[model samples]
Target: MTLITDTISRAAITDSPLLATLAERWSPRAYDADAVIADDTLTTILEAARWAPSASNSQPARYIVARRGTESFTKIHDALIGFNQTWADSASVLIANVVDTTENTNPWSVYDVGQAVAHLSIQAQHDGIHTHQMGGFDAAALAQAFGLTETQTVISVIALGVLGNIDGLSPELLARESAPRTRKTLDELLLVND
Candidate 1:
């Protein structure tokens, strides 16, 4: 594992035995502004998402990627809500996950898109990339900026980059970043009803 991954892993709090990559994976608001991700690396991460399972192979998930310093990136960043915009602006790459809702209304397309995004996140973690998915963006604004049709629904925006100094973040975000991770118990999540 890379030093960044090691540090994140040491800070993670996991309840079960999980793959090292999974355990190390997290959403970091502080990103290395100077870091630039390679095209090949981004392609590999997307490839992982491509292989994720879909309902009857509908394969509705699509990604609109914008590298930092580009107009597209600025558009995506501008669509973000207040707090998210403050932190996500420093990410090296921004990706908007969308789903095609043209053909079928099965509602499973959203789930498929979620799986694809999860795959992308895991692949990124394996590659020592930090990713933070945000739901605080204006979907309509993003669609307008990207020329997405009504058939396309924007699901989420992902901020991708290397970890950066916590001091770069505002005091509130820094405190949240340093806070311990927590999750509900398995019993609370899984229940058998008679």
Candidate 2:
């Protein structure tokens, strides 16, 4: 068994107490290439997304799920650019986060998709898997490859898998992975209060 020496804790330093799942969630590029997520677990994660709140229950969120080492996965991964292409191969699954505008049916479609993805991320963290969402990809090509309609947009792709050894990452990636996590304070976020 190969020993993993990655001990960096990237948990969020929130001003107030947050759910452990939300506080502990952090994107990691290093994933065990050989890891395979069970079908049930994958279903559970999608289930969480399915239940996420949508404006007037329009539920515009859609997903194109692909497992590693498959044609669909290859197409999705190939659509990625730059650093995302470098390490995303190790992830066990790549999901295209789709938003169904359906002829401008929902003005808040993108916002609803974000909510669903947030739920998915939280559930994946709870399920002991890591997720890295990327917006740097060829949306047009992915849409063509997947035969998505103009109304259906693939805004982002999610790389999901068990965490791998930090030592396995390149020095640049290691440094990025080890960097401290930060977020805007509630005070900065709240401009006006009643």
Candidate 3:
């Protein structure tokens, strides 16, 4: 996978090989303000999410997408907290990932939603779009703004767009954006039975 250095200095260097899209996929706070994703591209990304596996084929994951400059987008953006509000505005698309917890209320529903979002993010990366999933948002505020029912649980807010210059970011964020990516080794991650 080609190292991404336009918006950030560091790239995702893995211990072993990985899929190009997975290796290249890294969230950036700097998003191109003027770029708008095509409808077909957005559909393709969502289509990838739509096919994610769920418990009993429940398909509990749901998405509320708000393109840039719409009322929905503004509402979603306004719900961001702290540093997220500072950079998320430049993104071309904001999505609220939610899961239905009404009937089944299965513990695995959250995992299903996470899988769906992961699929969407990887697909976006393959299509040359960057995705940043944020947990620093007001879920209740978003739910109220989006008119989500009590049964729907907000999972995350995803910011999607092309990468942009880091000049506009705060010093702290700029440092974070350019920092080397690291992950736990397999030895640390895996638990072997005696």
Candidate 4:
């Protein structure tokens, strides 16, 4: 059996080890509509995200979720980018990650939200689930449908499910589906502390 290890050995030096895992956590628009995700599992994923570090200990992040085959889910997907809407149509669940910027005076709140969502995506992968973060969405529409308060700002939409058949995807999507991880070198990222 091929064991997929997250750690890279010195002999197996690559451009970036972090990219290996981060890239492994790629967002695929193609999802299995037939996949059934339990509510408990979804709750746990959110729970992990909730605990991520926030600036000033201000937990301003919130989420509005919807399962597939539901009116809410359909509406949320309808507001997605045309390309994303096409493939995300097959996702098993949808989650709208919102942030309360009114509670946070600093700009770090948005960065904190991104971190929390990143944690959620990584945890989802560990739980045998796949997630796609979408920025190409109508925030106002999602907020309106979910009865969001004026203070709450919608940050991103997440599509979750087991990966769908590659063949079911478009040629363009298929080309991107299995591409290897690419990133900048450490020389460009690190600074010499002389």
Candidate 5:
């Protein structure tokens, strides 16, 4: 068993009030192939997204999940950018998040999909699952191959699973794999209510 060390704890923040553990969350690109995400866990993650607020509650967003070792996952993963393929190849599961724009005729179904993804991200953190939200796939290829309707919008593909060894990554990717998070300060991100 991998020793429970400060590094893992560092990956998952154990402090904070509103967010008890999400601080440790980051986009994961690698995973253990032997890992099997249970159906219950996937359902929990979807349930979190299901409750996300939507414009007029039309809830047009939908998810199609494919696990590792399945042809569906291969069909989708094969469509990823070459750079992503190197690390994402080992992901235990992949989720194709899509939006149906016609569900409500609302112009912001895409934005609602974003909200749903955000909810899923945080929920993954809470569930001790790692996630990487990727936008580097060929949408046209996926649409053509998956029989996606004209009214559907491909939002993004999310890789879901446990963390893996950074050493397994190529040196170029390793340099980026474990980099610390950077964010604009509140002063830069927040605006005074004028």
Candidate 6:
């Protein structure tokens, strides 16, 4: 797929050929401040996560989606700690990926949630929107702010928006944004081939 971005080449030059959606997908920290995701596009992205396979169809995945300039958005952004919330603020949407732990505390529930988010991110990439999932956040503060029950566990936050000018970012963040993306070699990851 043709990557829709106004920045440097961020696509992953994989060791082997892969789907365009998978290869071109990269988390972007800089987002267009004026960008507003269309309602239909936003719903389509969320739908991808909804259809992701869950353990025994338990459907433990849940989300707290917030658009920019809203109270919910402010709360979620404020919950992000020890990180660059300034860049995140420009994102069109912020999603709180959560798990329903009320019952059936199966270990796979967390895995399922991750898969759902992965699907969502890939879909976003295909749709020409950038997604950045962040782990450095205050879960307890977010849980309390959203009035989430004990059973609803917050896992991560996703920032979604159109790619913005690299000049908008600070020197350090710009360097990070432009750094070469790398991953563990396939051989290093495989334990057995038989």
Report lDDT per candidate: 0.87, 0.89, 0.89, 0.78, 0.78, 0.88
lDDT of 3 by residue, 1-194 (tens): 23345623444677888887888888899899999999999999999999989999889999999999999999999989978999999999999999988768877999999999999999999999999999999999988998889999789999999998787778798788877888888788779845
Q: Taking the tens digit of each residue's C-alpha lDDT, what string does model 5 give over 52-125?
A: 99988989888878899888899889888898788877888888889987657878788989999989888877
| Span of 10 residues, lowest total lDDT, candidate 5 | 1-10
Lowest lDDT 10-mer window, candidate 1?
A: 1-10
lDDT per residue as tens, model 1, 58-160: 8999899999999999999999999999999889999999999787767699999999999999999899788999999999999999999999989999999
**lDDT per residue as tens, model 4, 1-194:** 22222222211345545544454566776677799888888888998898999998898888878899999899889888788888888888888888887776687888888999999988887777888899999888888888888889889999989876666777787666645545577677778845
Pairs with backbone N, CA or C atoms under 3 Å apart (clashes), candidate 2: none
Query: How does model 4 fare in lDDT?
Result: 0.78
Candidate 1 regions exceeding 4 Å error are: 1-6, 9-11
Q: What is the TM-score of candidate 4?
A: 0.84
Between candidates 4 and 5, the TM-score winner: 5
How does candidate 2 score on lDDT?
0.89
Over 1-194, each residue of candidate 6 has an lDDT whose tens digit, in order, gives 22334423778888899898988888888898999999999999999999999888888989999999999999999999756486899999999999998877888998999999999999998898999999978999999999999899899999999988777678787778877889999999999977
Error of 5 at 151 (Å): 0.3
Clashing pairs in 5: 11-24, 12-24, 13-24
Using TM-score, give the best candidate's number.
Answer: 6
